[model samples]
Target: MSSRDPAPTVSADEGVPAAAGEPSSAAPVEPAPVDVPAPPEPHRSRAAARTWALPVGVGVLVAALFTLYSLAQWRAYVVKSWDLGIFTQLAQRYAALEAPVVHIKGPEYNLLGDHFHPLLVLLGPVYAAFPDAFTLLVVQNVLFGVAAAVVTWAAVPLLGRVVGALVGVAFGLSWGLQHAVDAQFHEIAFAVPLLAISLAAALRERWRTAAVAAALLVLVKEDLGLTTAVLGVVLAWRARRPALLWLTAWGVGGFLVATRVVLPLLNPDGEWAYGSRLDLVAALSDPVGLYDPAKGYTLWLLVVVTGAIALRSPFVLVAGPTLAWRFLSEESGYWAPTWHYSAVLLPVAYLAMLDGIDRARRGRVRWLRRYSRYAPVVGLTASLMLLPQLPLWQLTNPGLHFAGLRAQAARDAMAVVPDGAVVETDVGLMSYLVGRTDVYYLGNDNPVPEYLLIDRQGGGVPQEWGDVLQVAQILHPGVPFEVLHARDGYEVARPLED
Candidate 1:
């Protein structure tokens, strides 16, 4: 077996190297296996980056566009009405350190009496800084519109990024757009955004953020605070321990601040009392109830019921609690049933509807799966068919069209009057216009003026207007009255001496 000199050649079977120049059947093989390092996981890191970035970018972009659109529309429509005058007068009053006492005119405008909402009073500072009503409108509209979009975006779960983005867009187009762009009511626009932020905070389990949002809600309208507090408690219970503690602290702090410092300061008169008139039962039972079916009751009810069910979702506990409170409280017009209230709930409702559809798809029940598949189609068809019939809904409300016409009439009537001349109006909006803060509001049982401007095209005379006219007839017995202008359900009457 030995073939070479120096060192004898080893046998291949022995696992030794053969001598140089001699070929062996088997070469030295690798040593017994040992541990080695693994390759880097770059793919996993890349996937995680994608998971978060997509949702965030989409959410921001959608919100920005929606807000811009609404603000532009508000700028166009707001100046055409006399609401600008009310805002302007109030701003001027605040600047002059004059705080007028708000009387109990009815459930609708009672909140106007005492400056109970310090948040609204902040408008004083805004007006003071800008001194331009149009500028203020643009800024407020843009801010709230963006808030609506962002909050709606936050409503969708990260798992359903597409649905979430759609929800933001849909809500902005629906409730947010209607109020911010069409009606241009500040209360509605602002509430929508606050509700959105509240939704986002609840989902994140950030107690401080939720509490702050709830606090802002209270500022918008008082009763919303109670609803928000109850929701906060529910969220805290779901989160447990440290989170609960923070939530409790926030709840307590907010309650104290709102009740002690803010409410008392703003509502000095404490005359914005709550009563049976504004009760939820009354709002529901009244023939002239706020929720008219022709306008959009099915959509509204669907939103409420679905949100309640969505509360049971394991993943949406935070949003669920807050939404539940909104649903339950909104039943009462006094609590939060105004058109603005809808803005807060729109995103939540959309989220709930999506959840219902998803649940139906995953259910064991065959009927449910079939129903879920057809539900969207059915809803869409119904909405389109019913949408054309919506104009009838506006007619049911006798006062809505009249109110718009009256505002227009007030603007035109004010154009001819001297700056300091007082013009009595059934409502206060006209007084605010034309820089005539001293005008006697026909409300509060005040007597009519020698001059009476009645906007006939506006609609049936307001009870207060009738009262003013009755007094004018008695006081100025044979005075000649001239009709200065007339159009669109409106007429202006001024007294002339023979």
Candidate 2:
């Protein structure tokens, strides 16, 4: 009764209980919404907004400086190949309205007749347009370098942007390094870009694009087609099912059409035999000494790594064919050795490596996760190991700044022959400079034109030239010759008192 009026009870649902001297309850509070800016576009650099400007600018400037320095020293580091002389001659002949043809005579000789390779044919127009071979060489260097970068960019989805950029840099730099060892415009270099495109298309599940690329690969070189076909099969298998059928139909059908129909239709003699060395095991075993394991280990490593990676991804279907070809296809004993041929399969290798690295980096594949961090490291290491052999900048300039020892040798060899007389010489440059055609074999059994102009520095000598049945010894063993030219340890000669 004493507190009945004083203690007014409040229900929990009505409101808050009051403290001794405090207000009953505070007004209900609502939090304000937080704001966040949307993410910037993918291609744009968010880092650039803050402190990236200085670093980015510095990096670009450094790169430009290196490019200029490399460009300046390009000519001094390159070596010329014998095949380049032949191709240049063909191009020059084409420019002079002469129908040019590549002639080969050997057990594995390709009988392809006048079947114009788009790349080889390009030489005609280039030679017609340029005053010197150096111009065409420069163009080729720039083209392949750009091609490597493009391929790396396009192939990155299998890995990621960062990895892809690494790949691009590796490929571009490696290509530049190797350019010094071979002819700048050799079909080998030209085929690289095409290979990259072909592999990318195959991986993208574009059967038609892959097929066209495969066909073109074959058209460029018969052996290349087989390699491409192997890669196509691997890609198709990885894609699986109905898609595989379409890819197969497209890839194989296109190859058949191009090799059996189009090429043959264009050149009656454009036929290549599946030689014994094309056997898979035989090539791997290097049964014929055409493939040297000791010398080709670096290239083989690339093949093995790529093949293993492709097996783990959908691209295995395409890579399978490539793998088979890498071990099976016969190699030309030309500018493109077995290792060089392996370079053509780099696109497949790159894709495989990318897929493997991605899986490893994502920690998705149990087998790959353990080595994830090291995958790219290994790849880059491999690239670095392979880089020096393929010099890129060297291709831009012939090391022949002035007629040096080789030129002097050539001149001396030329001096051995009579003036205004036909001579057979392996040194085509000396022949061109001396303006003599009807060049005959050194020791080849074929009829010697009037003289035998020999280059002491060339490939020992055509095997046919060494035999008594060959025209050189058979026609005139005691033919008097002068070493009219000598430069870079080369010699040009012609029979003088035959």
Candidate 3:
């Protein structure tokens, strides 16, 4: 994910401990004594270049494909939620080197209070150069792409070139990633690539790289601190890195401060709103009730996607925090394999599949070895078969990038509102205008906007508020508004006095 950081080196086999008689678990990181000796220096350089090229090429391709749909969504105005607008506004503030004040959230709301993501400040420069919501989507896809490349890098030595590249492509196109790309830009996008690099580095026994990646994850999202802690625990137990103990402490401490101090202090409510989700006492009292069918279905899909192979590696424990919080939370949205929720788990599952393959190949059980031998193909096949119904399917359509009549109408509505004016908007037209306007959600309480843009049939509009005038009156009680333009259920308005 780093411009300076080279991709994971494709040397050494990531192997498990040889049955009870094997020389220690660390025996695997070393290349098996090559009796054939080293290749000629000239040839070795070429071979190394080619070896690295394959994964790099695949990563770039995967990233392009993922970005394809992202651009399509942005171009077509296929916003799934207000999150796109929220991030766009946040990025604009950061670009101007201002506090993360997001008017889409509210006129005075600092987004750090919504979630402690100081890492997003990095987006300021990127957004400054590109200055569009699509930039966020591209950044997100490229991160996912890097993860895919890392997975391919780790898999190549384990599974060989053909199957390894297939697995990498599969990981990129996996249901979880596709769903996330389909859902659009989010802060969680950063976590996906970091998890992949950390797991891949761990697989190759690169403890330093693993530590760095895991540390970066804590900054991506507050909840991911637990994931980092769990990764450290697994690494410490797997090997004797004394530094890992400190890594564990770093993770635990980061989570505590992010939730208990940073988030609450930034939040207007003076509390991390999501802190309520961590009620261990409630979870303990009714552990059985937490076993809802939707959660089970989510678990089932995770297993099925990996063909049950991801369960073999203890590194899969990295997904524990991700799963634990989801199951612990009352939000049913978290329990399902929908949106960007499960994006972090994709890299963990695919890399763990590689780890699982190692253990399976070494196990005494013949059936297990055979299953491990084919797990990559099994996963790839499963992903390919499901691709048609996934977001990538849009890539095959003729109109994939077309901004339809409704999209044009939205662009028009947003065009009517001058840049930098305070504007209240519903979901459909909100993100399009956010790049320039001080956008507020239409129904929310805030300083009255100079303009109002509404999509009468927009996803978030209250169904009972059918009349356009009625909506404006509710937004600014005593003020009168004149409809400047209305087309295809999209409306742009201004105060009668303006």
Top-lDDT structure, candidate number: 3
Per-residue lDDT for 233-317 in model 3, tens only? Answer: 8888776776697777888889999999998998988999888867878887997888989889778777776778889889789
Off by over 4 Å in 1: 1-92, 95-115, 129-140, 152-162, 175-188, 242-271, 278-338, 350-412, 427-440, 446-452, 459-471, 474-490, 493-498
- Global lDDT scores for all candidate models: 0.48, 0.49, 0.84
Give the worst 10-residue stretch by lDDT in candidate 3: 9-18
lDDT string for model 2 (1-498, tens) is 676567774433454454577655665434344465888665545543333333233334323433443344332322244444445555665666665533211112222333324456566677778734454455455545544555565545544666656666665545322432233445555666666666666556676765566556655654455555565566556555344444445445555665676556545354533334357565557666645463366455554434345445544444444445444555434223232444554555665566655556676667677665566666677666654454433334434332233444444544556655655545344324222343333333444345554433443455455422233445566554444454453444444563
Query: How would the candidate models be sorted by lDDT, starting from the highest?
Result: 3, 2, 1
Relative to the true structure, candidate 1 reaches a TM of: 0.58
lDDT of 3 at 355: 88
Model 3 residue 423 distance off true place after TM-score fit, in angstroms: 1.1
Steric collisions counted per model:
12, 60, 0
- The numbered model that scores best in TM-score is 3
**Deviation (Å) of 442 in candidate 3:** 1.9
- lDDT for 351 in candidate 2 is 59
TM-score of each: 0.58, 0.60, 0.88
Report the C-alpha displacement of residue 255, candidate 2, in angstroms.
5.7
